[model samples]
Target: MGELKLMKGNEVIAEAAIRCGCDGYFGYPITPQSEIMEYLALREPWKETGMVFLQAESEVAAINMIYGGASCGKRVMTTSSSPGMSLMMEGLSYIAGAELPCVIVNIVRGGPGLGTIQPSQADYNQATKGGGHGDYQSIVLAPATVQEMYDFVELSFDLAFKYRIPAIILSDGVIGQMMEKVTLGEFKPRWTAEQIEQMSGSWATTGMKGRKMNVTTSLRLQSEDLEKHNNNLQAKYRTIEKEEVRFDEYMTDDAEYILVAYGSSARICHKTVELAREKGLKVGLLRPITVWPYPTKRLQELAQKAKGMMAVEMSAGQMFIDLKLAVNGKTPVEYYGRMGGMVPSPSEVLGALEKQLIGGANNE
Candidate 1:
């Protein structure tokens, strides 16, 4: 344990980045997530940890900077909101295509186009289903609490490097601005040049030290080569889907009705579970921690036991499609959401559960 401290979710991410021995951070200021860069700038980790913190002129530049650092086999990251993340889609696709390991945090706000600076889960489709122009996938982690926001930073780095792929911390304003007590983890030293060479020298651009130069590019001009690359990427994605599906099942052992959610929506659904339980309803909450891999196996298993399921979210049911596919007509699955920066309260969720799942409205 490093220390126990009260902190906001965004600030915790910054602190954890430094503690995790992150080599570089490049980002533009955005609402609900500006605290990440602000804290890093204030702490000046460069002086103590030899970390490089640079504020890019735009999100476009920031993600490209991450590309540059990650090509050199350095642990790099960036943070942004919904609109800013949109701007980074091109770079994100390139990073995925090149198989660079880096973390990108999106403290999501409501948006189709700069909609609002309030919390939202509308980016579910964008985040999980290739936000960029490629047949690629990024590992997406959704944190429901401040502690998770801190912990996921380290976890994201590890998974990113292990898989040689981009990892995204898909959070929202509700969690980003919320405060909580968190126990920090021990500091891990940054990777040395020798270690980088040993680990990623085959692909990473360390240098031409006694070997051929390493090239990191997403360009595959030839059709046969591009097809081969796509096949390899697809295989990796399948492996990730098999090995990395993570979720938290709350009171689901004998649940009759299940509620599926992630991020802040999961936190709210937890309370809704309690409220429904008090009303003698057998409702459980399935909170997906890894939104990309999506706990589909668990959902399929639960479909066998539960009568039906409900997808609760801060969006207009983006994740509902996955739930429907997971259930596969075995049991009914309905969607209940509050979009455009509106967060559904416990009472509202309970009401929806009663009307949609338990009250025979969806029984037919």
Candidate 2:
């Protein structure tokens, strides 16, 4: 173990970035996640690790800065809230089209417009289903605990580099502001120029140097070529779906009812499971760690065994659609949510579970 300390989720992100050898961070200050940039500035990783931490004028500029850094095979990232993330959607699309690897963290807040600063999981569709234009899917990770918030930052970078695509940490305000003990990882040195050439020279823009020039662009004026490129991207996504689906199942083997959730909502569902079990109900919690891959296979298998399922969220049930698709009518999947930054209490969630999943109320 490297070190043990209690840290908030946003601060852990900045610490993890430096320890993971991230090259740069470009982001604007946003509520519930401003600590990410503030901590970076306080730590001064630029002096210690040669990492560049720049506070951009806007989220739009921040994401584009990541695009530039990533194109050169540098490990770059940015952090934002719901509205700020909305501003970066165009840049996110360009990064996807160019197939550059980078990490983006969204500490989501209530949405639709400049909504409340409180936590919300309303950005599920925006993060997973191509928030920007064109056909693209970013690998999305949901971290429920402070420890996971630390772990996933490093994991996101690793996955991004491996796939040459963007990876998103789809966290919420509760997780961002919450504090817990975390076991920090060992420090890894940033990659050198030679290392970049050796590892990413094939596709990265590292100054031509005795080889044919490389162009990184999403633009394909030829229709046939564009189709081919799109097909290739789809193939990669399929492979990722097959290989990278991850979730956590608690007390599911003998579960009569299953609760499906992710991020902070999953934590609440865990308490609901324990409460239900205490009342002689065999309930399980299925928490999706990778929201994009969706863990549909595990859900399908569990659906066959459980009598009913409830999709709990802080939003108006955005992930409910995915749960229904995974169940595919084999079992009743009901939605229980509190929108506009309101989180359902454990008692409220248990009550909904009893009414919706146990009492056999009409699931609509």
Candidate 3:
């Protein structure tokens, strides 16, 4: 077994960044997510692995910093809450339009504005639907547990670099604050400038010594050229949708009712599924690991088998839109959610499932 220790979710994000060979972390402190930077500061990984951590002046500045570092092909990242993320939207658009690879973590809080510091999954639409202007998609991962909070940092970087697209860890305050025993993985050495040049030199702006200079920007003045660029981006997103969809299904083989959710909501729905099964209802869970490049194909398959599906979220039915689209009227799709940082209990979810999908006369 690897090293095991009990740790808060936010702290592990820091540990994972250092261990995964991150070049830098440029972020502003925000509620619930502030510990990510604090933990990094406490560990002082620059002394050990030469990692760099800078608390930026603001979220906008921090996202631009991420764009700058990613432009050079460095594995850099930033973290923020909902409102702070709103400030970074334009920069996120620039990075995506430029097609740079980087990781971003959003420890979601409730809201349209400065909603609350309480945990929420309300950022689902923003994270998956490209909150930034222009047409683009980031590889979005939702972690339901503290272990995933650690594992996805490395995975997000790998996927981001592999596709040269941004990756977002769509976590919430619940996972960020919750403590759990996580098995630490082996460390990867930070990449050298030489290594970065060797790996990403084709498009990365390493010093233009031996080859043609690499120009990175999102500005395409010509309409036709911008259209072509957008088409290319769309093609990349299609490939990702085909190749990188990830999810976990529980008790699905025999299930007649399916509960679809992601992140913290998925954890609650899992218990709801069990509670339902104990009462002789055939319920299952479809927990999405990758919210973007969503597991639509699997959901479509589940729709054929299950009597009905319900999407549960911490948002006001954001992912429910996707769930319904995926099921495509083959079977009924219902929604259960809580907003403004309220979390539903397992019993509440189970009650919703019965009322919405199972107990209804149409479902029966």
TM-score of each model, paired residue for residue: 0.99, 0.99, 0.98
Model 3 clash pairs?
none
Q: How many collisions per candidate?
A: 0, 0, 0
| Model 1: how far residue 109 lies from native, Å | 0.3
* lDDT at position 141, candidate 1: 98
Per-residue alpha-carbon lDDT of candidate 3 for residues 1-364, written as tens digits (9 for 90 to 100) = 5689999999999999999999999999999899999999999988988888999999999999999999998999899999999999999999999999999999999997988899999888899999989999999999999999999999999999999999999999999999999988999998888989899888898889788999889999999999999999999999999999999999999999999999999999999988998999999999999999899999999899889999999999999999989989999989889999899999999998888777774442
RMSD to truth, every model: 0.8, 0.8, 1.2
Judging by lDDT, tell me the better candidate of 1 and 3.
1
Ranking by lDDT: 1, 2, 3
In candidate 1, which residue ranges exceed 4 Å CA deviation? none
Query: What is the model-wide C-alpha lDDT for candidate 2?
Result: 0.94
Clash pairs, candidate 1, are none
What is the total number of backbone clashes in candidate 1? 0
lDDT of 1 at 12: 97
> Residue 260 in model 1: shift from native, Å?
0.4
Model 3 deviation from native, Cα RMSD in Å: 1.2
